[model samples]
Target chain A: MRRIVTLLLALVCLAACTKSAGSDALVVGTEAAFPPFESVATDGSLEGFDIDLMRAFGAHINREVTFSSRDFSALIPDLQAGRIDAIASGMSRTKERAHVVLFSRPYARVATGVLVSTQRVADAAGLEALEGDDVVIAVQRKTTGEEKAETRFPNAQIRVYDREVDAAAEVAAGRAHALVYDMVSIVNLHAQHPETTRIIDTELGIELYAVALPLGSELAPALDAFLAAETRPGGKVDELLAKWLGDAERFRATEE
Target chain B: MTAQRERLVRGAVVMAIIAALAIVISLAPGEIRWALAWERRDLFLTGLGLTVVISSGAVGIGLILGVIAALFRVSRSVALDQIGRTYVEVVRGTPFLVQLYLWYWCIAQALQLHGLFGPREAAIVGAIGLGVFGGAYIAEVVRGAIESIDRGQWEAARSLGLSHAQALRHVVLPQCARRLLPPLTGEAVSIVKESSLLSIIGVAEITYHAKNLQAREYETWAAFICLAALYLVVTLPLTLLTRRMERRLAGEEALPVARL
Candidate 1:
């Protein structure tokens, strides 16, 4: 009788294990190369403002949140193919991207900034100085920075790297005249190459950072509700902002 | 070319073209849509043009480096041979992508740091990286071809009052040409394929544009399929040339006098 009971329990457990996954878990895809928002820590695990915030949301909603690292460009396509649940990378909610994917309410604000060699810090007072034909502006491919460079500096040559760090390296090494990227990345670049590179004070335009979800996703409302609550004063978003970025007041975009 | 062989080559080329097209059409996500990408054909064309330029530049520099390194490898001096061996071993042992980063960032940065050379265009740096990477394998290929020439040929030339350099230049080196052609053409095709790596460093090659198109258009499969087709178009001639050289060499082997 005991043996029969053990056999029946084993069969039930096997059947439960073989059940289909019905969205109890959220697989968040992120490009960890973007510091502050998301990046790989020394322990070879993902840790950043976005990673923590996603985890917090998972805790609140009573679901398991898993993280996957991907190239910045591959995140959206992966989401569309049902390979990932949400994109928590430092992706801007631009009109072009919004057309294809649903974006959560703005969680963070970013603006375009130029990073130049230390010698050209004063000369490159604004984007106008970088509009010359001889100027070579470095940008990460398929980013808003590339679009801005193309529209803002028609005469200036544009060089696109796979990673923003490479473009920053180009500017730091003096191979390229300037790097046009997100203000946070520009600040990070200046921090990394303090002696060789500096960030321009002028911000091009305000851009919003948000969590991207697949079109018509059931999780959109829950994500937006979470973001709405967290973005308030003394909320989780403020805590994250203070923790990741110290006194980045000037770089913040005025929410419209 | 023999009539039958030419016909065979032609048939193979047509079939390859058809197969390439079929693969692109079949692999497209959902309904086949070419107009979305075709409307932006200029992007692909520009990328193809840049790829050609980079590959040509890299091949030019690689040939020069390969020749110099091959001479060191084949040299009778121990120091020269050691230098050649070290370069080939070091370069061949490492990954091409890492070498490219070293070239673009570390080495190039050092040059700029010391004021030895000013900022260079990424394309120029990328071409040099590809050249340096290709030079190692090319050096080995060239060295092998030169060594394959019989020891008696060198002895005969030296016996006829020719200096060591003259014997190598006039007799052994010239005879190595037949053996070198097929392999050299093979290397050229590889260089073309390897040029795709330059996209990482911002050379704006075909692969770069393809990636951009994919990300922007969200036609991931279409973008890469077009990229594949473009690469095939570029490498097809070199592949054919390699085959032709191998065939010609095989036919010529039956007649010893014709080999010369």
Candidate 2:
């Protein structure tokens, strides 16, 4: 117990010291499991649409950007507590969230999609068709998908996972009837496991994605201006969208 | 220091520490509200019920596997001894989280049994994973307890015309029971704590519910504190019971062995 207490005290001191020392660097928290937005590459480096955009914004402001990978649910609490200056994960901006954090202008629009086993693609065509007591739906924790599953399929068995990939894997394994997650991630999972999983035709409503900062943060105006300037045609946002998502009709249809 | 003074000092120190902690929590921030978690008590209660069920299932499985493995280790046959040792070593060597995934996703899928599996099947697999992982340590504990008995007891029973199996039932196992109690209780408590790892596989236990609540409500500290408290509610009684048993057994240790 004494040794554990000593170790904890040392850790607290270290955290305090490092936090004070890195005031100049902007710390951004992200959950890197969502593909096309934020994900770790095979080579152990962070690379994705959100990552590139955050780095571009950091360059615009002339501050060094440091990315910290955390659980999806932890991003907001970390930002509120000042552990991270901003959140750039593929998080949808909602009214409930806007009450707690300052959201910059919407950067992109994405829709929730459903994934099912290839064999069930013909039968389970939409979310409504799978609403039953026996149907098992897999959703990533803290995502809009979980919210939708709770409200839509009130009787379905909902299994929550930390990552979309795991939920998709459940669909691929035939353990779960469907996976409710962002269309981009669902597309990514279908590409990776083409033989086992297929996309459902029904698309959930489009949601605006934005960067979240602590309430009344000084960084809000600058972030908004940066987003406004870079989201136009042939700007950094367009280039990132082209580079990461390409001109796929399914993706373009989700664009606002 | 006098004994009375020592007790008073200890009591004062504990109260002071608790007071300091309370002050720290109170000073944190307006957003850190504990009441937000209290409203979702139903989620936590259901999760705790599942946690108890999983732990009980694991304990039942572990006790059965442990005894069998212990017997194999103490047996004279080389093949049985090798199988016992290999089972213990392999289970103990791997991380429990990886083992859980291998059991739920890989092994269950390969058997073609998980296609229709849901929460119920997931809970059963979680229990089996925890039990298989814990059986190794329980095997060692039971083996050591059995070995602690004097070999002369077996010889005396045999000379008295008792069969090998009868000698074990009449002479060895009674003494082994007392020695096994403490370690077995400890193993059971450890299994209860280890059941938290089942949350990753989607068993809706206390930690799983806590994570969901934390994610949805963003009450990280409140959600986790409630989880820790629920675990303590289950584990503290077991720990206290073991301590009482150990005390009673310690007194019995002073008495002479019962006459054969």
Candidate 3:
């Protein structure tokens, strides 16, 4: 009977649906708020160094990479839950984070610095000069820059902001005395608001950015291999740095 | 069966159904294992407590502001009524998240210039933001409930030589309270859900803690399921209580509605 055959077909489809279908597509999670790393444009398209790198890596690995934007704090959890295959946000590799998720090879090195209002302070020597009870520093929450600012300037009142732009804006608006963040982001902010803000010539410390993966994930080794080949002399990484950073010499200087 | 006995039986059956479904979902080998969430109960509980505290604080503030705004809205004075109407329209028109940011980032900055508050303490600002936002909706509810009462009640109170304030306080508001209860409960639930937005500014509420667990454990399904269950625990009781209150106020027999 046609009805019996139809019932049999329906049961077969239901059975197939119950079992998880394995796919080769890679779901990459990113916090698109960090510009030049991963940022969403006005048209809702993702554009940044991290986006391009992931697409290039996906091509190298022969997998269809799908990107999902999430809160910066939620990216790792989404990855661990298998909701995402990997993270391509500009996340720095640290010992504490390595306990939970595997990290790919370091893609780029960046120094932390302070951004101060040009009108407020004429010249700043280093991190110590800016340290005092009266000076209030703004830093993005859950960042190494925040940690560094806390330790380096214990006397200074620290204001933690959810977004790097907000922290920079506080300094620009003259509410906060200075903003502590990665040098690349500070430079970008200064470029955008040159008259209001200036990057203080203080090198806090160097940190390396890498892709985060779930622990014991098969994708980890593959991403690491791709990063190794692509970041070699005059490779894809150099191309990205030139395109986004504008001056490859500054990023290259800290390479060694 | 007696009406009270029947209601008790119905309540038991519903609870049993919920329990059986929970057991089946937890024991089933699938993407969402409730056990994963059960293990992180402490973290979730802390988040829930914070959520309740923030929402209740907002609700408390909202009630006072709502009453004042409603009074102003129905007042004889044109200026006061216009001010009240504008406050409700402006607040209700904007998204809560934008209002939150406006309070946290812009207004907080302005306040800091006057040395009144610090921008770093965002939780207080978030509670105040939720309160101000909820007050607009609550004002409408209060006005509607007050207006729903017959104009005869007001005239009767005036004939009894009661002033407008005395009549509103003694005669009309008591009637409005019963009509207001269900919607006020709904507003309270919404306030609890909206408290999740506070997590954006890092308030360490339930959603924020859930994200922390998800990020750390990498179990999104389990983390979110737990989050949903925790919220249900907070909201379900209020919903049942509201239903019971509505039934009691209606003077209906204590008969349970039949289930499928």
Candidate 4:
């Protein structure tokens, strides 16, 4: 027994000693399912405004940026665990999240909107009209839109989904009364499935999107500085905004 | 090189090596600071509580289903045996995550459509799903334990005028308990570990809370180490209990023999 225990102890020590060799790459976490911001393409590569911006930031810092796609709700936990050095998902700067993570300067602004089946679009008139026990609201889990839906429509039954597209599909199938999400995502979904869904004109609220870093992280100052320089007039932020959302004047007007 | 001194030296060396590793990890820059988990202890406690609840509920359900499936497996009827075999085969063949989604997304969605339940019931569905999955494996453990007994034991009970059920309950099962304890404990541990998957469907178990804390604090190493320690608290006691039960069942044979 003693010999076996000694052998196991030696093996454990060897494992622990080998694991301490670390790397210099900056790991960034994102949910690559949210489009016009970040999404997976046909070739299984991550692409979007956030991906481009993060790659640019990585180049500026002279560190290789590695992206890890995870569920949006999981991004903060991954960041906290040091699984990822930063979050470049289209996360909004909210008071609740700010308590846990440090947010860089707002890179862009987005409006929250409701998407409903065309038949219910007239009934959905606005956020106020959708608040009732009979209404079922679908929102992506851990997103600003879900938080807003929960607080604003307290009576409505809220269903949280893992993906934005899933939430939109619930409304498209008429199983859900509406989906509360960012305007750009809802608009894009509506454009793709025009016959099935429509975006309600009622504006939930405007939110500023920013990158999230660990609280008191050593990288926080450097990230904030980079973001400040990038968001300046005629900087990388403008170029990205033009490339991704410029086709629509409304989206361009919302850019920070 | 006395045996007693040799054992003491071995124990001391293991402890010294462990202490060295602890120091190295603590001194390393950017290493996980375990103290960070202390700040979010309440969150972890909540997660631990949910994990225990889900695991216990699933294990209890699994044990009951296991007995039924085992009975079918050992029964004389071909149809019943086939039913048991198919259930165990199919459930054991598929991935657990797929089964969890089937229960949470498909079955739960259908339940909601019929107004039988709502989305919040996914945790209950998840527990039951885990139980059903575990039952398939547990069924095999039980069948193996029962079959491992000598054939003459059943014949001896029959000669004493006991019915099949009475023979099983009073004669066969009592003996099988000793053989079954170790593997049953192993199954229990697996069920507890698998409960972490419940987090994907939003069960808010230990892994979920760990992720939440990590996301909130960005202290990845601290959160995971704490998570591992919490799981150990559940599994370690079970392992010790199994050993104790095994020794107790072994009777005087388990006692150390006197050196001649």
Candidate 2 residue A21 Cα shift, in angstroms, is: 60
Range of the 10 consecutive residues with the lowest summed lDDT in candidate 4 chain B = B113-122
DockQ of 3: 0.02
Q: Model 3, A19-100: lDDT tens per residue?
A: 2343456778887667778764433356788899899999998988877665666666556545567888888888878988
Tell me the lDDT of model 1 at B104.
Answer: 61
Q: Write one digit per residue (lDDT tens) for candidate 1, span A34-128.
A: 77787654333568888998999999899999787656776776567555789998788989998989998888888788888866545547667
What TM-score fits each model? 0.51, 0.53, 0.51, 0.53
Q: Which stretches of candidate 2 lie over 4 Å from their true place?
A: A1-108, A111-256, B1-13, B27-30, B115-117
Ranking of models by lDDT = 2, 4, 1, 3
Docking class of 1: incorrect
The residue-by-residue lDDT of candidate 4 on A44-158, one tens digit each, is 3568899999999889889888776667887886566455688998899999999999988888888998888766656546666688898999999999999999998999999
Residue A125, candidate 3: alpha-carbon lDDT:
55
Which ten residues in a row are the worst by lDDT in model 3 chain B?
Answer: B112-121
List, for all models, the DockQ compared with the true complex.
0.02, 0.02, 0.02, 0.02
Work out candidate 2's RMSD over C-alphas.
Answer: 22.7
Candidate achieving higher lDDT, 1 or 3: 1
**lDDT for B183 (candidate 4):** 85
Query: Scoring model 1 with DockQ, what do you get?
Result: 0.02
Backbone clash pairs for candidate 2 read none
